[model samples]
Target: MQMPKRQTDDTVAQAAWLYYVGNLSQQEVSTQLGVSRFKVLRMLADAREQGLVRITVEHRTARALALADRLVTTFGLTEAQVAPVGESNTDDTLARNAVAILASGYLARIAASETPVTVGLGWGRTLSAMADNVTGVRNSALTFVSLMGSVTYASHTAPGDVCVRLAAQTGGRAILLPAPFVTDSAAACDGIMAQRLVREAMGVARSADHAFMSVGECREGSILFQSDIFSADQIQQLRDADVVGDCCGVFYRADGTVADIELNRSTPCVQPADMTRMDTVLLAGGLGKRAATLAVLRAGFVKKLLVDEGLAVALLAEAEKQGK
Candidate 1:
């Protein structure tokens, strides 16, 4: 069959534009649109900014969005959100209860029925316990992804595994990220990201509707070091930077300026801007995490904070003391 004349010209323009204007490779464009690599390159160089693309973040308004609002203002989040928890008592119980609530609440907030949702999860004993506590679940099609890998067998399943279990409950999909939380060198993280699974998982994390995470102590390793994610040297470095705690695996100063660490480049768990992409950064965990969570709030990563009465009181008291 003879190729159409007009079609040929369009494809070339599109590929060239993708390459020059969009900073995308011919291979990536081709993969996204199911076109040949040659056409992708050609069109990328030639495509126009006006007609090449249109972008928007779809917001699904909900009651939760309102609660998310109050917290966002209190915490000064770019976007805010809240999740309803299941019943609980123990600290771990409260933590998991929150996840179930978060799951149900996230489902309620989706205004579109067809959009793909990806979630980045950090692991803590509290988060792991939350998985077991999830109840009244609704979503089954959501994609749950792992944000970091494990240094020990005990950490194998991770949030990826928890996502799998939660997905099973909701009938959703689970995408696993393969790289330990901390490594000896940044290059090691870069090497791991080269894998197909790791790359795809990161893409998912970037597009999540909202991220549900807990605070991790940095001066020491919180509960994570027990899992072997960090070494003595890494902890010492955090101490040097006056890192009080961490959010996910990202260490930060009391102000949350991601302390210059050795593992960012190869294994960028997520940037503050990256986390800001979502409308909400739901912060969970307690007591052990009060200082860490507050620093993250001051840095403006989290839009909403979910905590128990006891911790809330402690935070107020701590804040007041600082004021004095």
Candidate 2:
């Protein structure tokens, strides 16, 4: 049966918006638009076939898709998404923003679920960009929980801030960990983790249905060093210990083993072991993060990955070299 011309056009447009912009599933769109699932599918196909929806990216789309597929196969990832590199191919911010956009889309789709969900978030510039790009989504059943403690100083990229922004954007709730990212000593960290509020928040984090996190390079110019969360001596010490990068607040070596350092012991964040129990998505980009990204993947914390073209190419090359 055919819908009336005007009604069909309106329905097609609405279905496109709900699926593309709203990030709703086909079933959800069918329910909200008061149509059959098969009809919703047909409308979405019509929308694309008629040029009502257009998807544009700056990089070579075909190459990016192939790279994503290779990454999934080589790394044993459940899924992988690669964003195209900009003209310069050297702009770290642009690469990060591209990857962030992919991450934002992933989160939006997850937020559209009918059942309640708890999402654990980690702190970083990329994650902040993801939070900024998320819009037009309203799901009260979604809850964002900070997987790590807050930065000592004010910063929009802090875990607490990212959680709050995500919660605000989705009309959900934010559960923040009320402790410092790193304490002065292991004893201090232990004491903070014992607090009622901190324990409750951590419990929620550990039980999260899914978790999104970014890796940090264990180097001089990394965010941890720039934020003064770690001093020059500390960075040098980590390097001395062969530390390559960190996920959440736990630093690790090139082989994916957690570094046995005092800094790691004093950091209050959900451990990597806990991440293995949930669906963990690792978002990273920029050419400089190749080593760090590889390290995290080796650590086996990532089930899915979102990255830019340059990084994706580098990772594939690394996998080839290692004969993976």
Candidate 3:
């Protein structure tokens, strides 16, 4: 009789640590431990079954998970990650950070893939936080491309900045769009887009396998307004045109249709139509963005989403109200 294969406690403990403590997914743990994903899953199950690793789900986390499932089902998204708001549901910064952490984990997993991947990046505080939170990921096969033009002023949340940071973290290359976020006029924008360097960069951005973006609300306190990219009159004009939010420089109305406005024509970036060709992950949070988030989702370009509990609940309620 042959001896049966034995499951070791030491291996189980290492897998648990890598997954639960190190924040690595099963696939990542498998890559690190030189084991199959099935083996890692079995080890994790064994760890839990043996009571060696205690996993507790808080009420807020449980609620967030349920909301995430509803979002995925309602919106037909490939995946939805909702971070628990805890005691600071009203705190936008906290919510953004929580969602960013989840996005960072997702990006890390993508970077760990053996196959080369070109990722397009969009600008926002949450995306900036995601780039900042990425650690210990070094894949030379990765390429980070800016999906939009650079902000006129320096900002960590700018598309170029986020792309560079992600590239640095992953030991990858960064391709920056050599144009402004918004040009002076439509003709100027056309001229810039026609430039060889800008055209090449945009080609890379458009051909990226994966993309990450964030929705910007069309409000006075929005980042676009704060960046001085749009004047008070322009902001009011967007509001007057029923513009609810923007993604990749394409502003949209509450009904998810692109707004026919001067800003939309002048802003040079990846269009919603281009986004439909690739896997796009949208990261957004805060109650202020609830309407904007819904509008972007309705636009039918996002494949995955990462949001906080407050935003998730608001989106679900809004979707039901709209009879979606």
Candidate 4:
């Protein structure tokens, strides 16, 4: 994600005008230019050195640019968006809404891209909110595949339902994984994976050009805990292992290492290693999910992050404490 040293003069001038005159943030410029915010900062600096911009306009990007730079440098991320949830963020609910709306914009841009797209998705509340807000597009070449199995309830957080809704919104096809997020035993999981439809779903997921997912905290307010998908003893065991959060159904500890638990075997989730191959966008927020979000970031599973300011602050603080 390093900034290029050789950028066109026009590009640098445009970036300078956007930051100093147009009153747009670096994130907005990054989105408009299809480049990283780090690059935009570099371009602005270049503009200053070349005497292209002579005046400074008080704009929001100044603060957002600082935070985004720190996050990308600290986490080694390709891109990071630290969205302002609101002036007052006492409960983190507003932050979640802002993140969902922001994610919808990102999804719409991706759907409108020129190249064909096959997006892989994992289920969670943040992702569900994004699906609800996503602007419908008529891109027949875009396809969505559920990266994990489903929950029984046909709700927003279920993989099958999320994929279906996203596909419907984008005017594409949905390849849902027809199985539970977790089965009674590993043997049952294997039986479902053996099905042709399930195999096809896996193939589609693995072939995705872009992937979107969210982290799940293993706590009282977590969707997994409330869904009754796992027994109380199992949840307790995860706590004993210091399990912080899960991405695509793979639980990991605070240090970002995968937990060696039997529950993973009982779920037909995509391998975490495979996710690193694509452009992965992780959308998550809330103070309650701070630890889990940090864990997923530490695991190096995400290339781009879309998070609220509260969680972004917590992540940077934790990363600094851990010497990340």
Candidate 3, position 17, lDDT: 94
RMSD of each: 18.2, 9.8, 10.7, 13.5
Clashes of 1: 29
- Candidate 3: list runs displaced more than 4 Å: 1-60, 231-233
**Per-model TM against the reference:** 0.65, 0.80, 0.80, 0.78
Model 1: ten consecutive residues of lowest lDDT: 49-58
Best by lDDT: 2
Candidate 1's error at 70, in angstroms?
7.7
Extract clashing residue pairs from model 4.
none
Off by over 4 Å in 1: 1-73, 77-114, 264-268, 320-324
lDDT of 4 by residue, 1-324 (tens): 234544577788889888887899999998888889999999999886775754312233555567778888998899877677532465666677667776777787788888889989998778887876775467888888989988776776787888888887778888888778888777888999999999988988988888898888887777777878897767876878888889898898999999888777788978878886888998887877788888888898789988877777777888888896
lDDT of 3 at 121: 92
lDDT tens digits, residue span 216-263, model 3: 998767766777887666677798898988988889899999998788
Candidate 4, superposed: residue stretches over 4 Å from native? 1-60, 86-88
Q: Which stretches of candidate 2 lie over 4 Å from their true place?
A: 1-60, 86-88, 231-233
lDDT of each: 0.59, 0.88, 0.87, 0.81
* Greater-lDDT candidate between 3 and 4: 3
- The TM-score between candidate 2 and the true structure equals 0.80
